[model samples]
Target: MNNHSRRRFLSDVGKGMLVAGIGSNLAMELGISNALANDDANALTFGSLEPLVDLMQQIPVEKLQPALVHEIQRGTELKTLVAAGALANARHFAGHDYVGFHTMMALMPAWRIAEELPQTEQPLPVLKVLYRNTARIQEAGGDERLHTAEPAKLADTRRGGERLLKDMYKGDMQSAERTFAALSQGERSNAYNDLQHLVQDAPDVHRVTLAWRAWDTLQLLGYEHAHTLLRQSVRYCVEREQERLKKDRPEPALRKLTPRLLDDYKLLSKKTGLRKTDDAWVEQLAQTFFAATREQAAEAAAEALAEGFAPEDIGEAMSLAANLLILHDPGRPEKWASPEKPKDSVHGASVGVHASDSANSWRNIARVTNQRNLVCSLLVGAWHTAGQTGYITDSPFAFDVDVITSKKLDADALLAELNTAVQAKNQSKAMAVVKSWEIAGNPAKPIFDCLRRYAVSEDGALHAEKYFRTVTEEFTTTRPEFRWRHLIGLARVSASEYGWPAPGRDQARDLLET
Candidate 1:
């Protein structure tokens, strides 16, 4: 094809088509170009990821949905498509771009969502995120860049983790990457465990969730790619450390505090306890964390673990402390009502959401990590929750169930009221309805069923899907009496962001429907 002919072909294809949503060579292999009756094209492909990753990166933003939908129809596995997206993201953005990483956070949740949907519609969530993924790749000009760091030798096997943390904290990217690469070759779980130090370095939602999500994604992508997946967290930590140093911010106190807490509590030497505590103990621990200073919170958590309280029980208390932030949040109504505020500003990405996600991550991390990391994670979760003290109002976000005329409303009626409150963006009413349902001895299933509808449909500023999944997983892991609280938090947040659809949600849906 001549230059003029190619130009004429692009113009004839319509300006709205934007970039191609498949690699040029793969397009040829799939006979996709022949389908379009075009014969000539040029593009780059990375043999490491081959056709799928290249195809994902080449996808035009406007056509990602239709393109993915086509691939699904042609017998492509959804997991393969998602793996490609993850590889494409890690390769291009290397865990640096805001949009790139947020999309990365959503990948596993989107895959989970796809599993529950009917076959034809299963790809919706996957396509929605891929659209965002490819759009950012398009904006950045493309995914020609590759992760170029070569693996290095660890000087001392016993102290590699220590050296890695020190290098990361000092903003030494080259040293950290090399150290992480060396560690990545040793043992998959051990490699993942070492990085938990950085995940718990501070309470940033993106940092914690990305680390957890990347680990979660490994289950799908397989542990063989663990190094590539886990490297994102290392890079993220080094980048943040660099920024903090450049801005002259104080070193995060947790850097020093976490290690001290582990030693003072003798936590590193103790085995994680398996004894579950009673409801009163859980409540008391939660209150202690709620009112304690950051140091006090860490101490209380250390003491609990030292005293043989189950890490899950200790985590339950931290989870309650997080729910308290949402239940007691005092932001003015206009803050949520503003068109200018990001949809997730108050509810989706609020301090409460961050706390919940962070606590959830730390809790799960404790389950899989080594004893030292388990100890560090519990302490970090408590400290993170208590750090948000300024956001806790004098009272709980008002959800007086006493206002209801009758406590005897059946499940359907209660759910109706809950949906009404959510649609109206009435946070207080939503909480009241959920509490009423809980008080009525109703099964929690009906309520989760109600929230699942909104979770799948709303854009939630990229948070709804993940937070809902977080709450659902935590519910099963939490004690019976306290489990209802997670539901109430979800209800309030779902209600708060009820009407704000994701920016391009309609277009993605329309593409799928047609």
Candidate 2:
């Protein structure tokens, strides 16, 4: 074809009809007549001819037409999705309902596709996932798909997953309709309850796809939900990758296990791995994966993997996701440190966490439902620790590097310096003293030592025993140089009247007490 003729497929006058809702590449392959190409649906184009099209085109064209709907994410559906998203955002500001925030955010994007961006719509793959798990709605002898299930039942089962439980209790008489209904509802759950339900048990191809969409949707609603979801994905991908490894390794190690299911599973897993990460290699390979366009993020992720940074790259990928969450919520650190601010910033003798809420000590920031952020942090932290330690044969936890600085860093006198800084409300000096040990290449032990000698007793105004223990762990596990920065970040949020290096100035003396 001449360049001019070939270009006709793109020219305004020669614009070809794009069969959008359904991804049928067969129509493109059978040499779709140039006559019909410019005749119908607007000049839209399918991103690529996905293999799923092979199954799609097999159905009679008449039936395929009914299957496809030129669905637009406008009108009543648009209002509902936007309204629900707004409501979820409001609930999040209340400070106690993170899960509720995520839930309301997850199930709305099916109705809110963005304009002028080539974002992969989540609804289609979600449909493919449903098709794989549910009983065939296509008839045996005929082509018509008359199996229309109840929309309300499907919606209810998905929102709470209550229907799945009810169906299971029926012992021998489970309803096939209900089973399909339950599978259909699975999209909204985020597998928040059971990680495997999405990563392993659910259709393999859709796991990350589902996560990214929900992650994208929540952020669009202007709530800081992606970081939590990113943390969850790190765990999900690790576990799923581990399972894939075990299932695919050739022979012998199978011990008492079967090989048939294992082999097919390997093949299926490989196909899934290819599809999920393929786009990541081609386009925006480096634009800060999460914040960039979808194609860009995928390409960046692929480039990272190709550069021999697998497994760890996932953590690095997670780092991008974490940045998005943190950047979105400037006050999150302070909120995490002490969620409930005092009525008027008044200090009762000492500015500190209320003794009444003391029973909930340490405020274990690791949410039970999603510990991915904590786990991912530990992973990065260890990597940071080893690099600082010089990666020797007999690996010591802390490095021996003597970071150069203008000021003298006397380790033995750190406590006195810390006290001096805190008393003067000098955030910079106080933070520097606390961080000096880290700069000296052995922070964990010294930080712990400082806490042991000066931290007030069990019920002290500020509990450095517990807080210091966590910081010690962070020092030992995270990037050596950055560990102190994390503390500084924390202090930034938890600042008291005396200033932030030590929030609750009155109680600040408790931590520095000799």
The parts of candidate 2 lying over 4 Å away from their true place are 1-299, 302-308, 316-409, 419-425, 448-475, 479-484, 487-514
**lDDT by residue for model 2 (1-514), tens:** 3323322334222223333322346445432322422222221121222122222323343333223212212111232233333332222221113232222222332233122112333223122211211112122222221122332344333333234323322221124233433443444233333332222222221233233334444534333333223323333333444455557743222121212332332322321122232324322221253344333333333334334443333332333232222212222133224423232221111111121011111111112223332232222221211111111122211211232234565666765665565455344554455556556565454444433222221112122222223333333333432345434422222222233222222232222231
TM-score versus the correct structure, for each prediction: 0.87, 0.29
The worst-scoring run of ten residues by lDDT in candidate 2 lies at 355-364
Backbone clash total for model 2 is 7
Instruction: Give candidate 1 misplaced runs (Cα > 4 Å).
Output: 1-49, 140-146, 332-345, 403-408, 507-514
- Model 1 per-residue lDDT tens digits across residues 251-359: 8889789888888878878688888899999999998888789889999999998899898889999988887787787643554545634433356667777788878
Q: Which number leads on lDDT? A: 1
Best model number under TM-score: 1
TM-score of 2: 0.29
Candidate 1 lDDT trough over 10 residues, lowest sum:
34-43
- TM-score, structure 1 vs. true: 0.87
**How many clashing pairs in candidate 1?**
2
**Per-candidate count of clashing residue pairs (backbone under 3 Å):** 2, 7
